[model samples]
Target: MTSRFPTRTSGPSSIASSIRRPAALGAAWAALSTFALSEPSFAQNAQPPVTELPEVTVTTTTTAKKKKAAKAAAPVAASQQAATPAASAPSAGAPAPGSRSGSLSVPTTAEATAEINRTPGAVEVVPGSAYQTSTPATTIKDALDYVPGVFVQPKWGDDSRLSIRGSGLSRNFHLRGVQLFMDGIPINTADGYGDFQEIDPTAYRYIEVFKGGNALRFGANSLGGAINFVMPTGYDSDLFGARIDVGSFGFRKAAVSSGGVSGAVDYFATVTAQETDGFRDHSDGESIRGSMNVGYRLSENVETRFYLNANNVDQRIPGSVTKSVALNSPETAAAGNLLNDYQRNIDTLRIANKTAIRIAPGTLVEVGAFNVDRHLMHPIFQWLDYRYDDYGAFARLSDESRIGGFANRLIAGVNLHNGNTDVRQYVNVRGQKGAQTVDAEDTSRNFSAYFENHFFVTPDVAVVAGTQFLHATRKREVEFGATPGETEFNLWSPKVGVLWDVTRNSQVFANVSRSAEVPSFGESVNVGPTVIPFYDIKAQRATTYEIGTRGANANFTWDLTAYRSEIKNELMCFYSAFGNCNVSNADRTVHQGLELGGGAAIAKGIIANGANPDTLWLHASYTFNDFFFDNDKDFGDNELPGAPRHYLRAELLYKHPSGVYFGPNIEWVPEAYYVDSANTLDTEAYAIWGAKIGFDNGGPITAYIEGRNLSDEAYIASASILDRANANSTLFEPGNGRAIYGGVQVKW
Candidate 1:
């Protein structure tokens, strides 16, 4: 893979960055640890001992009270276990029987547990806590601010490019390789590409990132893996609330939500609106989103839920900045930039449902399905006009149960999805633009079904196996630019793995899986006379292997993973000349890296000797990645571009039981290879630190202030070579010099 933008052909040189001290972080951790460890020994005690059930009557969501059967009428076997407190007693301040839990406060679901255990590959789940109090970013991409291993570059406020373990290369349009899902519904269009604008970060309950084979549960089409954004469920408890915020650079946002029970039913609804005047010229956008879920109880043994989500976004493109422009005026636009001269708008809608049934003792079955539709209108360089429409549907089924004797548990599931898409291109002669005329139209369909099962081979071990079958069909009205737009083929993907429980709180696992990615619209489109003619491109395939460990013990929790992937048909890009470049499938490539992450608590601030506050919190992650081509003829002995070699992020949080808090954070990137293939601009490594302080009234009203880039270091986020500069380049986007913003919130 090469730089997404055109850059000098010289090699890139990297200077190792120096390590710095975070004394504040160390102090915060020590404090938190001390507080947590010294807390009343009773707090660490397992669930309280239980005796016979009380005669108390539990009110159902429907306002219907069911009589508690006499102990003598209890079911035979598990009844004895019910008399004891659950291994994981509810946390302190837990919601009442059927009330909704706070957004980031909900407990993990069954699917989440399956992912935690059955994964034969590396995976990480960042709870909502990471986003609720941090950055003001509006998209899911923003939530990844300090996440390690993953690299997300926001083009503007609403659009971003994401790469994990170096999978989605040569992609300038939609996201490839990585599959995205929300509430079990596919977020990618019918053509298998995802856009960041479709996601509303504020609406999600939690995000799960499954890398390599661990994603087998979703399917093989996701060569880089899958990311699922879960939403609040009816079983959760909450009330209606709204938040409104305004900040620097014409940024504004508002969101509202309602969750509660009303008669044998639980429902949740959320709506949000946001707008921004981008840091660069012509970089402005506005968007609105809404999501809702309702649950119904049919009987003692059955429950069902319905979900709806939608988004509308409008924005102007602030094309890539030239190296010079990027460094000189990072927040300014180029004089006659074609890329940033266009306008684009997107609209999308989604609907889905899930049902769970308790078929027998310790056995349950679940089914889920959803549909998504999206439309995009894009203007190019103020000269070219384009339009696209996509629609897709997905369905899944699975069963969870514990078998006899062996003390074994099993989880098996299958998924089916299909999509259809249409695209058109036109030229706006002279100024007036409105999709002048249809230049191209194509429709594609993908049908796939996958199943995987987890078998507990022993009390301390488990094995997992799964496979996917995908058949695709494409029909194009015209073909001229790149590859044959019309095609058909069937592919099979398989995976297997094992996990060993090191202890009750920790486990280790490893697995190998196969994945494939088909071509995107731009990859097959024939554009003009100077551009190369189209040719059929095969699906990119890869074999990945990963191993990791995760554990949690009252005071400390950590997760780590190491992985490597060898790719065949890695699509790479090359610059030929002015306004000319080519995208060709490579023979082979490799990606390997390690991700270390964990968090710890140390001190007790205002809370009584470790009461209910996370007095001090610490979280950190480090990732090292290396990607290169394997004996390629065209591009020789050159490292893949874009990502830095080593990335590190750490945070130190301090809080007062009264709700006032302060946090200091840092992000470091080791100078690696530059964007260009030639080692020309040997980039230097750098580190940036930030601090945030806030006060909470304890009962709803809260205010906070933050300052980023406190170091005020000169750094570049993105750069590109100018067509007129020959070998010279300019920075397109400059990391903010220093920024300060603040906001307040109120809840009832």
Candidate 2:
């Protein structure tokens, strides 16, 4: 009745990645049994149109509404939205203001799923065709692995450690309480910290998640909330394209893209490059990225867009061991990190602009500005040189009429981030750079303003409200020591909610909120002989309670949620050193959760000749966490470590309608969780299985093959946190054992 992995340190060399796991599962079940005995051709598929619903609403017009709008067109998206199609009305070239689905500044994906179905709480819209036709999405946990209460892991190359709900359970590295965006600008760094390898998950085109406080349209007041990737415009991309990928430790990648539009202008662009040679040992990495955007049209109620981005990254650092050396040797390497050659490199550039107007016809307005230039050359344990100069601005206003006549909507926004940093330190000799110890300058400023409203009363109800107001600042200056000074904050956060619509594909919501976070600069750095230098910490607050339900028909679809939070001062770190980190504050805490995602269509004509027939799908997601501690005098109520109280993901598929799919997936963690807070170190609970085969017809051609951890399981995909530990804790990080991957894409 006692054994949470306590001995075993000699294993892990893995027969060269398990000998390509049976010729990649024998060519993925011989291409799924020769494509299930031939039968393909869907008359070049169709779908895409439906982005017009304003003029104070009221479009009905049915009588079979032009025969269900020519049987609902087609293209892009359908990897869940319960197989698309729903939420209608608005067609007839209806986009009289700077097109692109009636530009409210780029939306589409059915206006971002009708603004996350009028948000009340919890939101998500991941659909890059759900993992680009089947995984290996080069990180960000393969594009938010089924996003149910979001947790994300990957901790090497494309570095990750995302959190939402249990938001940053004790500072680990980089990232803290989420917030990152692109196309809505701001990519965290004005004291808030972020670097998820500058995100290039194949250059997005669908990704938005606004949890807690529903992120009030990006005026994000953390507690793990905002993420917006969205990119791909020239009206939804693909005028030209190319892709390539190969896998298993030594992975490779290549990419190209282009987009167009003439007269009134429009554009899109992309470029990528990659490298890998990791699976532990020094954990290799490399990257190159690019993106572009352009749009114009100054009449027809105005429009404007312009943006560019670039990045270069290189990483190497595979340190974190003990748990019996991460379950028996786990590719050893961690102890001065390869004799001090640990690394992290980056370079970046960004520029932005946005504009929109349409002051009437149900109103709209937008504005923007930005600038970023970063560079960091780290060699660990000090040999860090940094430089950053962030800047930002934004504005928004949206309105949908009918006040005394009921049905109303309004949104407001403003945000500005400011930054400056230029710090340097040396003395790592092996990774070069000897003498000099510290020199500094760090500054940050932030201002945010937000508002939201929806007033319906009935007609399927609505009553949601919002608020956010923050003003922050932090400063630092040093050359020798003692100057852990300057800090200020003015916070306010509020929210209220209610939304219903029970049928017509279900919905019901509830909310109660308030959240705030302030203290990034990795806890407002000090580096002196500290006895205190969290700059008087304080500003973590929370107050949440949520409820949820989502719907779909024609064989079912779902998304459920539940939440609870009650916190204060919760910014923890509990001690560390490999070059400082002691962080502070924690006097109460509690976070609760449950999320479920769905898809069914369990069976139907397994192969019934033509006209798109053949079905059988089941995709699932589940998450349940219960973070805690509320009664501390040095840890009393316990239970607050690093995630995993229970998590699950499931999949099963076989769908042919000529967009082939093949699946088998599972990732489970049944129990065992604790990484420290004196919960006394623990970890051991596992499940991993995978398979894939794909072909997507949203194109000129597409292909895929995948396999992972096919039972070569050695588990532990993440860990790193400490308050106390035993059995010589180095803090695990292993996972990724059996693998194979492949890809191809072309478009025109």
lDDT of 1 by residue, 1-748 (tens): 1122221112111011221122322332343233222222222112111112112223463332122233223332121121111111122332211121221112243224433544555676655545544456475545765455677656666777777787675564457778888876788765677788878887776677777656766766766778888777644423555666666667788888877655457777888888877767777778888998887766555667888888777776666555555556667765444433465566777887777665654445667777766666565543332333444444444444455544333444556566554545555332235343544566667777777766666755668787887787666665443233477768888888886655555556677788877766545323344443333767778887666666555556666666667888876555433332245577887777666676666664445444354357676777777677666675564566656788787877776555566788888876734555443453446788988787652344556677778877766654432112233443245565677666665543
Q: After TM-score superposition, what is the CA distance of residue 696 in candidate 1 from its true location, in Å?
A: 5.4
Candidate 2, residues 1-748: lDDT per residue as tens digits? 1211111112211101121122432343243232111222111001112234332212234522443343234432244332332322112222221224533467766567656667876787776667865665778788777778898878777887788888876767778888888887878888887888888988777788888778877766789889888787775666678789888888888888887555466678998888887888888777888988887766656778888988877777787787787777777778787787777777788889898887776577898898888887777776777778888888888777666767667888888989888887788766777777878788889988988887777655679888889999888888753354778899888899987655444555777888888877666333346455656787798888777766655665677776778888888766665423467778887877677777777886778545556677787778888777778888887888888877887778776666677878889988878888879888889898988877764546677798987877887878877767777777778787888898887766
**For residue 684, what is the lDDT in candidate 1?**
45
RMSD of each: 10.1, 23.8
Against the true structure, what is each candidate's TM-score? 0.81, 0.32
lDDT for each candidate structure: 0.59, 0.72
TM-score of 2: 0.32
* TM-score winner: 1
